[model samples]
Target: MKKIKGIIDRFEEGFAVIEIQGGTKDCPKDIFPKDTQVGDVVYITGNQVEIDKSETKKLAKEIEDLMNEVWED
Candidate 1:
């Protein structure tokens, strides 16, 4: 078993679009936790996906800071 990091890009139909190292991949939505959402950082181990809450929050803050910088006058 191996652990891979990814971000939840979006949900479509019955799948979740995940951004991985090389590109994006789709996995069945049911395989993820029910509370999962877009922008969540996840760790994939075999067929299981687990949310990395701290990483997700850190990423959100980084993006927010970038956005704020861009909008500052």
Candidate 2:
């Protein structure tokens, strides 16, 4: 297994496109939370492009809540 890190380019339906260190790979949506968006740095562990549901969901929720904070509309 290898560690892949990159920024999320796009997320739609149940999939996400990540610009990995070597290349871009399609990640499943379930791995990440419902609120994941573009430009978020993500770390994944796998031989091939795959989604880690637990890890992604946990991080996604945390990021989602943090992004929801607003000082002024």
Candidate 3:
């Protein structure tokens, strides 16, 4: 397993585009937390950081709802 730091770019269906220190890759949004955002920094592990579809969907929805509420003001 490898650990790399990256910033969340956007949610695409069930994946998240994370801009890593050296390259950009797709990771499951659920791997982090529900509060993750476009600019939030994250650490990823494993050979490939892909996340499960069902979990990704659930977390993405939660993140979307949180963003909406946070930006409502």
* lDDT agreement with native, every candidate: 0.96, 0.69, 0.69
Off by over 4 Å in 2: 47-73
Residues 13-40 of candidate 1 have per-residue lDDT tens digits of 9999999986999999999999999999
Superposed model 3: Cα runs more than 4 Å off: 47-73
As a whole number from 0 to 100, the lDDT of residue 29 in candidate 1 is: 92
What residue pairs are clashing in model 2? none
Q: What would the per-residue lDDT of candidate 2 be over residues 1-73, giving only the tens digit for each residue?
A: 6677766888767778888766888888677655556766677765333345566667678877787874335
Q: What TM-score does prediction 1 earn?
A: 0.95
User: In model 2, what lDDT does residue 39 have?
Assistant: 64
Displacement of the residue 59 alpha carbon in candidate 1, Å: 0.2
RMSD of model 2, in Å? Answer: 6.7
Candidate 3's C-alpha lDDT?
A: 0.69
- Ranked candidates, highest TM-score first: 1, 3, 2
Best by TM-score: 1
After best superposition, candidate 2 residue 66: deviation in angstroms?
24
TM-scores for all candidates?
Answer: 0.95, 0.53, 0.55
